[model samples]
Target: MSVDTIYKVILYPFITESIASLKAMTNLQGTAGDPFIDNVDDFRFKGYAVCSDVTGNLDGVIMMHHYPETAIAIGNSVCEKMFDEKYEHTEITEELSNALAEWGNTIVGRSTDLHGRYSLEYNFSSPYFVHDVSDMAKYLAGVTEVVTVPITVEGVGRYYFNLLVRSVDYQQVGIKREESRGIENTHTTTLETSSKILLVDDSAMIRKALKRYLAQLGYHNVIEADDGASAVTMVASESPDFMFMDVVMGEVNGDEALRQIRAAGSNVPIVMLSSVTDKVLVDKCKDLGISGFIFKPIQADSGAEIIKDYLKIA
Candidate 1:
């Protein structure tokens, strides 16, 4: 994806929310610099980078690169806000790493809410801290794209917010330049309420969220499965017109369940949902012939659009 496409579709929402989050949590006024393509092959970490792996509608890693002083300042600020504690350290300490990782989780987790507003879908991993390494490129092995935006935190110095993508299709993910221009003008295609939709996930919260979103989109004939094994049984019995399933689950993971369903001769439009973008898992799902894929922390509007695409509105 181009830098602009990446910015508008993904980074913009993240950076906007991130800056706001930084202000609220650390009470630090921050500004985002213009985003630019970074040379991944020759990239170097300034001191340390806190990284989160992202997958689904998009697949990549996001890094918050910081200098020693910047990391210390931000880490201390976060700790003070969270635990009323501050750190005194010349180098990265375990406590500092824990604080940064927790802050990173808070920032990325909050960003998903805003992503829904933009009809975007993607999943993010828990943040982990990485120190400056001699082989930076090797550490980021599969990343094909990189975009960097500098965040200038008042008095704390500047830290870089970087997006690194393994692979992504802007158009397929509904963020193409031409289409993005008219996104606001697009209208929702309402599907008939008679259609049965299967919602499968171990989390009642997720099932509840999807039920609400489906209700808004005029699909009320919904079925629920708490796990993948149950999902297979429900498909045979309910014969749902559309289905949404989480990839990772207990008893039977989604991929195995999908394989069983396919083996039993069912071709229902099943969309796989997950926060993981592991190539092996994605490729396995594709080979099993999934109808579509959605990144976790699903948004109502974005999920509705995907459902519409698969089960065309009547």
Candidate 2:
């Protein structure tokens, strides 16, 4: 859909009712130009996705956040809320939480489509519930930049239609960079765990780019080892948090390095990162217990996500 065509208001009543309740505002029957919305005074609803910069402040920890995957999952759930099971909810919080996490996973993937202006890079961290719309700006006080897209599910049926980015930036996200662009200058998540990252790759270019990306993801400590043998040494001595292994190298390929590491009793997540898409070679790594596999030319955001999700970092 055109960015201008996407607004903040749903044609369906069921969706509108929930949006009103979620925002704790008066009952809204928003159909056309700006229906009821939560968070900011300027934000209204169209179909899905809520996009606005109501306060005219676009710096520090922009919350381009989406958790509507919960709405989709819960919509299909076989509960009183879903299929009308017996006794209908003394509690449904656990299911809702799981639904929310799944929503984050799917929405993050869908966002890759709109990452033209800025890289939407982040893991699903503990969310701060802000009831008051005025306090949303306060909730995202520190950090840099705030972009919020409300992925709204409109209509009720066997399968609801999803609008992942109901509203995106009306204007281009101000971006200027040396390399490939389309990313906010600053987005730092609070990393609760302190684990060392060992990046194993022969290419200097890949290593440098990855190291910078890790730092951008708020991973302060990352150690880079050039070859598989050194990486194996780090596995034993450094006891690193995780390893990113490049598949092909002059002396030893990733396959050899992986088997050696596994033999050494290091169960740390080992992700085989390679440009080689050959099906047979890829399968071999799978047999050796590679924690994750990502192709070469990995985007900074995508790489960080594989790491966070596979490791379940808090």
Model 2 residue 102 distance off true place after TM-score fit, in angstroms:
34
Question: What are the clash counts of all predictions, listed in order?
Answer: 0, 25
For each candidate, the alpha-carbon lDDT, in order, equals 0.70, 0.44
Give each model a TM-score. 0.51, 0.38
lDDT string for model 1 (1-314, tens) is 67877877777756776686576556478999999988878777787887767777788888878888988888777655543345466666766665665456546644543454344456666556678477466556888778999999998799988888888754423322110101121224433688898999865656766787677678899999989999999998889887888876768989999999999999876777765444467679888977666654343335455545555322
What would the per-residue lDDT of candidate 2 be over residues 233-285, giving only the tens digit for each residue? 88999898777788766577788988898898878767676643445666788
Give the Å error, residue 305, model 1: 40
Cα error, residue 63 of model 1, in Å, equals: 1.4
Please report how far candidate 1 places residue 142 from its true position, in Å.
Answer: 3.9
Runs of candidate 2 with Cα error greater than 4 angstroms are 1-193, 300-314
